[model samples]
Target: MDDSIVFHGPLGELYSQVKAGKIKTALQGSHTRPCKFWTAMKILSGIKNAVVITHGPGGCAYGVKQAYKLTNCRNSGAPYEPVVSTNMDETKIVYGGEKELRSAIREVDGKYQPAVIFVATSCAAGIIGDNVDAIVDKARPEIKAEIMPIHCEGFAGEYRSGFDLVFRQIVKLMDRPTPERQRQLARSVNIVGSKLGPERTEVDTDVKELVRLIEGMGARIHSIIAGNCTLEEIKQAASVAVNCTLCLDIGYAIGTEMRDAFGTPLNSTILPYGIAATEKWLRGAAVHLGMEREAELLIQREYAAIKAELDEARRHLEGKRAIVEGHDAVKALSIAHMLESDFKMRPVIFNFHPWSTEARQTSIDYLLETGLDPEVLITKGTLKFGKYESMQQTERELLEYLGGVDPASTVYFGSSLSFPPVPLVDLNAILNRPRFGYRGALKVAKCIKTALDYAARPRSWLTKQIVFPPNSGGLSSAQSLTSKLAQNLPDCTVYAQRRKGRCMMN
Candidate 1:
């Protein structure tokens, strides 16, 4: 194995230890998929009385509900029952919870009469030997409406792995063959690999663009795998001639399975992240479908439009530096590539949790190809919530390791805000923004340009010694200082407010 092909960060360390010699690289923790949540939200939003049952322990169910709420689905006052297993206690774990789960499902089914009910399992359910599949099998005959069993156990693998498991379950339920048992439409394709919901306008935009792109190639979308898809639309997936798998992690499994089960060929490609990558991805898919000419024309149009927008952004961000931290290694790598290749900017570091050898290898390859050193990347920082004292000891150790770099140089991603003074970027915002495809790339480039320009504007408190008083009204003194310094600069408000504290921006 080439050593240069492996990139190690905090999460990668655990993965490397776990896999040992078995695998080359891995990703750490589970990265949430935006499309899956969006799909579920879209379905729930449409149905007046729908219930989403997470068939696992408290934490797993909590994560799912939290993801839903974070995506801004709950604010709509949607009539949906977000239920979880209350009986998932020791007894339920030791023996088996099939009876309890079945009862829970039936009760929710009867009470809600939901258009669709989704039962998702967790790591505990998987480890304790719960037969979720059998439970779904037994309950299917009795349920009046569609009861989709999603096997998204956290222990099943990583976030992408969970997506694959859940998506496969959805595919199994939806892709039943037509009576004629024929591929009904040659011009139709199934769009796969969105784990987040349509609540994010960007996700909605991407799906729509995909539909337009496919349709422009004289191919219609038979069904989108999950993003903004309904129960009925999912059932129509079998009619498609091909499955276009984007977001490689989530789509690979389902696409391959659909190809095998329905004879629908799978077109696997990296997601369109930047202008060039987007065009390449679109062209690749179109070529596979024998629509290269049409794809080229569409690409030319998008490329020209995006170039004009990016040119303006590049003027502002040309030589700036940035750091990115997220679980999606592919997206991170692609962003780094875009920063260098398109914007002529420098990405000082791109952090990821290593979980799989393949993930590590892929990221390493991307960084190497882009001429980035793996050493500059930092990963494995302590993620916690609550008072600063809890992280005091770890913070000291981290500060020592970080050395010359200012403490504020660190970037925080997740919900927890326990860390000491660090410039935080809400991971949700980074992932949710319309930052995919041609137009998306230009929009993101502009956003990055704005961020870099803001960063360069001199601020009083660059040191991490500035502390935020608990619930100090709006902006803290540090924030005020930063804001005052950057007030004269254009687009500096975003940075000024963001640097003040770890407030959720987006």
Candidate 2:
């Protein structure tokens, strides 16, 4: 109801907001977001030859499987085994679904013959007090596949906690090494924080780019924690010299646990978006294994290759204002770092919820390490609705915000769903594919240069007609679908746009 900009300030000020209960004020509903069961399924199903037996209603099982497993089939480049479920219903909820769960787990293992079977509880199972661990304990010895029971009851509401839980469960799978084996693992490092694989984190190209850097330093990756790794590799991950967490938010919890569990030192910061972050990231990993010299040489080589591209892009982007949104606080800040520190642009990050930022403190810790501080904005759209409506509102809000500012000099750097009166930079463009290390800096420079070049021209006339309101100032002179929706014809506007292929996902 209160559709206004919620807050804006530096990172420290955002922290103050968190302390002041702004985050609590924003996140006030139980069903506001998907529960941890869905998140846990997403992580577990990413594992190679893994099966997840959901102990919940058919709806819960289907929703999570369709969203996490079935959809990711293409993204992961590996077909998923069906997500099995106990199919708990109203009758089972009143009694207990333990019988159905035990049968589901055994049936999944026998039919799929997977390497691991993760028996996960849904909110329904938690509500009904199904003893999932007891069922798993009874069934583990009899099952052919390695079986683990993950308790999802305590982490019902928040989805992020699921990532933390699954990764910690993975820590239980590692085999402790003798002191000699630990010494042998000096050049071996494990990459933590990735989902069961590459689909959830950075794209495939980005992951490979990070791998290139590590191998360049002559350090062997023991394994990526569940990211294209085998169960055997996970068991070997503990003996590694260090754990390099690609994402601190998801990785920090497991990283610290591994450090405490195996005495494997954790590099808590390795986001590596810009030159500084990448250099720092490489140094952080290399220093632990005494490979700093090799890292420095590789850095020099990377700098030599990227310097010209970086300089040329900086020439065009310096002093330009950038608006970044769509990503979480961690990733958005990393992008801001790339735009400001690497390209000499002023950055404004938007839509990063205070709760998510506060909960993922390690990202903020890295920003502090670099002393890279920037302004952050929170639009009313962020707290107002789900993805689809928030996108529409955010676009209108972006247009309004740009109309009030220097639209010509400002650029939006986020989702392509937005059509603000400025240069558009599609983050997922192929030119920006491997946006991770030194080479990625080159790709990013090219991406921005292309965007700025495109902005110099008038927008596609079709885009103007469909997105901007008729007679709008600065950019266009046409009534858009957004303007039509402002008059309460959302259904008609959406249908018309869909007919024209303007609203459909590519």
Can you tell me which runs of candidate 2 are displaced by over 4 Å? 1-4, 22-25, 28-31, 76-79, 196-204, 386-393, 404-408, 461-506
* Highest-TM-score candidate: 2
Residue 1 local lDDT, model 2: 21
lDDT of 1 at 471: 41
In candidate 1, position 85 carries an lDDT of: 59
State the RMSD for candidate 2: 6.4
Candidate 1 displacement at residue 445 in angstroms: 2.9
Model 2 Cα lDDT, one tens digit per residue, 121-194: 87788887887888888998898999898877535657788888898998898889778878878798888888
lDDT of each: 0.54, 0.72
Clashing pairs in 2: 196-226, 469-478, 470-478, 470-479
Q: How accurate is candidate 1 locally (lDDT)?
A: 0.54
